[model samples]
Target: LVASGIDTNPWCDEAKKQKKGDNKSRKDVPTDAATAAPSIKSHSDFAEDTATEDSDATKESLASSFGKIVLWMGVVAVLAALHVYMSTPLTRGQVVPPGAWLSYCGLLPFDPECENAYLNVNFEGKVIAYNSNRDVAWEMQGDVCAAQVGSCVRGLELRDNGLIFVGGKRIRSIRVPDKSVSITPWPFAEKPHLKISRK
Candidate 1:
């Protein structure tokens, strides 16, 4: 076909050139795919960042709740301390003056089986022997007279040193108000009682 010097086979050479161009385009497809791999990796990194943010938010909420609990506990502790401090009596020493009658009754009033006693103080600030209720007139005795003989007896004597004697026994402490006297007796007594009557 070359010896004839004719252009009848010219379309065959153009077809070969087109086929080479197509092969080059096919080889470029793999390079494009390789370059896109970094974008997929970036998407995974973005997802991890979102998860970290959510975890930080959860930690913050938990910390806030813990702080509130600690604050409330501190407030409760302070209130309890204040309540104890306020309920305690402040005054001390022998405050009951003479002529102040002291009485004690066990459990109930005027019960025959209960321990009931009374102290009658004369107008001269001296203890005197009187009736059971300390209402009847009685002879004045400089010595303290006890209503009952046992440890639960009701008797009061003001000593010279501003101390008190109950049933001829010294008391540890005494609290006296306008119309009542509170005394801490010896170990044998069940509990202290206060009922002051001014005759």
Candidate 2:
């Protein structure tokens, strides 16, 4: 009872159910056009999230500039150790006077082998004496032969009959000889026996 060839067609079952519904609507129309649109990510995940937010904002701006350069290097090492502790120098306190210090300095030639002299004083009131070979030297500045001599410098003597200079309460004389220094009344001159000659 075959109709001569074989076309059991009911429209070929309705065109095989319309080609299986067009292959299930072409696989659900590309999954519904890839779930209908938006998702876009891959350029390496948006360049790795913009390089991890610019490496966490460059590590928080290099930890805020290394904490302000370690707090300005501890304030410049405490101002260079307080400027080397106030420019150093005044070595441990001072107070001097011992028979006005240099007792007999250079020439006391009334006798005593009559050797050249040598002496020196310190503690601010400088005085120096040298001879023998030091080309005869003498320097005076303060404690003029002490005796509580203060008032800025009130005492000095070198007498065989010459050079005496007391301060504050006055007492001066000068008559250096043997050819070296002389100041006959020329101590505080205004013509008080004014005369000074040295070579």
Candidate 2 residue lDDT tens string, 69-180? 9989988788655433322211212222323322222224345664434344454444444444544354445433345644444333332233322232223322323364
Instruction: Output the TM-score of candidate 1.
Output: 0.30
Best by lDDT: 1
- Give model 2's TM-score versus the native structure: 0.27
C-alpha lDDT values of all predictions: 0.48, 0.45
**Candidate 2 segments whose C-alpha is farther than 4 A from its true place:** 1-5, 9-18, 21-27, 30-59, 90-199
TM-score per candidate:
0.30, 0.27
The model with the greatest TM-score is: 1
Q: Which stretches of candidate 1 lie over 4 Å from their true place?
A: 1-47, 91-199
* Residue 39, model 2: Cα distance from true site in angstroms: 2.3
Scanning candidate 1 in windows of ten residues, the lowest lDDT window is 181-190
Model 2 lDDT on a 0 to 1 scale? 0.45
After superposition on all CA atoms, what RMSD does each candidate show versus the true structure?
A: 16.6, 18.2
